[model samples]
Target: MKRLLLVALLLFKWMTYAQTNLIKNGGFEAELSYWRGNDIATISPYDKKTGKNGCTINQYVGEQWKGIDQIIPLPKNTIALELSGWVKSDGVEKGKNEWNTGKFDIEFLSSGEKGIQNESIAAVVGTTPWTFYQKRVYVPDGASKLRIMLALGQTNGTLFFDDIKAIPITQEQLNKFQEEENTKRMAAIEPSKESKVTLFTNGDFENGNTAWRGNASTSNTVTKEGKAALMIQSSTFDWNGIDQIADVPEKATTITISGWLKSEKIQQGKDTWNNGLLNVAFAGNDNQKTGDDQNISFVTGTTDWTFYTKTFPLPSGTKKYRIMVALGFATGTLYADAINVTFN
Candidate 1:
């Protein structure tokens, strides 16, 4: 009983430590002043020069060290190192080739590279309070030093940074992240239990339903006149009262997004778009709008009704997303059902 109690206490302490040990726990580690080109200080170092209001070592401009500027001691069985940070820009915003872009890059090396720096490019920071940002980086088996940089790009902007922590995540943490991701995906595609699908436009009937309209701009008025049965065909053009969002739960391992899609008639004409083959992309749109039928389109099948499904590993940082369905110059009909999201 005593041994059990002690073990439980140790586990509790470990959990507590993991929950609060993100980078930037104790403020800035060091500060660098571009005034003196060769001035270098320790991580989270003290700074006499301040920017904005009254800058201190904790809030100085130029490249600064986040957290304890201590080189992370390489672990024995470590696979990768994920570096993350947040920045608020405050510089003369300029365009490309303007020498005022708020550009910044994070560099990593086995040893602090004086010139040959391995840089990871990122967007420029603008006028905003310190916001949270993160990125997962894969480190080679034999890596040692890591450094983050902030410089003036074509859009130089005053940048403030905070909260930078680096720790080796265990396999357990990875699994938890995956599980959280799957949970978010499931949340996005929940069945509306009360999906009140109103008949907008039926090709079979001449003027029974109005043309597909509303938030999801759809048009189901075109039809092919048949002798016996009038064929109905229309794709769900847009989402109805749906927001473009991505969610992930805690402790997620593997995320699988699946749905039942059925379609009849394959547009196989010489003048068809992309040879009558529809495409479904994760993040792409020609009009640059969410759920646009023109982007991320899918193909239709000919013959009898058939179901199609696909599954893939979820990207580490990707949690939730919106879905878009589209139909091009095709004949016949199409229907989607049982759109389900699951985590295993």
Candidate 2:
């Protein structure tokens, strides 16, 4: 019993420490002790997501990047890293360039890069209250260093960042995550009393596309429940679609997608791709698309509260999947609600 208790304590400590944030002054209460940057960045005491302070980045000139960065040495065998934090913006407008905005960027310094930095950026724009942002990427080959950058990129406005984190994920944690996902999926499928988890965020569109994004998509009152739903129009362009990227469990066997869709005035696409469907596109751990897309059933023409679902055997090498509502080339309006994705 004593030996079992020791092992249990050791396991608990390991699980707790595995997700410790690597950033030193991420909360900004330390006042920029470990971070480095230019005059555009400063510690703001008046507004913050947590604690006493937050990092603020502003660009009145809009001529250059106004932000800060911190370079951290990664631990040995860091499988993947998740960067996340809260962002609040005040009239943060971009320049003529599209990429200019509030950006939480990561650059992995790897020997295999040969000098070119591997960059992953999660950008925020316009005005918003306290909002959460996150990005997860696989560590590159021979990676030894990480450059965490937060900046207002050529945008004329004020932005505040707080409670940032750089979490190194291990294989053990990934296995546990996969196990939890399986539990949720099974709970949803079976008649058991286990509490089922809602796998997707804001799937019902009640938050008015808060968790969904696309050029041609907007939240409308025309919902199945008459509350709110995501409305997509093909007039934005051919292949106009809205999608959310979701992490796939490693070695996951199959995934099932389901949702209710409503369409009106959907026309023939240039390639007969015009329809309401789930396009499950696969991506590798490096977050690059593998060009393999499973286009589920099609809902063409006018429809009201039509249900669609499909189960696909996950393609090998998939570390993530993009769940998309696409109109292909068709011209019409589509409404989507209660989008769900479950794993098996």
- TM-score, one value per model: 0.36, 0.50
Clashing residue pairs in all predictions, respectively, total: 40, 0
Model 1 accuracy (lDDT, Cα): 0.36
Q: How displaced is residue 14 in candidate 2, in Å?
A: 14
Q: Measured by TM-score, how close is model 2 to the native structure?
A: 0.50
Error of 2 at 308 (Å): 21
* Residue-level lDDT for 250 in candidate 2: 46
Q: Among these predicted structures, which one has the highest lDDT?
A: 2
Best by TM-score: 2
Write one digit per residue (lDDT tens) for candidate 2, span 1-344. Answer: 64356435433543474668998889998988888864547888898999999988876663577779888888876766767789888887866786678888888776443333555446777888998776556566667888888887776788889998888876556445433432332233222122432235776777775655454445566777557888877642234566666666545789888888888877654234446666677665555455456776677788878888889887777666777777764567888888878888
Give the clashing pairs for model 2. none
Per-residue alpha-carbon lDDT of candidate 1 for residues 16-120, written as tens digits (9 for 90 to 100): 434433232223433333212213223322221223221211223433332213333444433334444555555435454533444335445565443334544
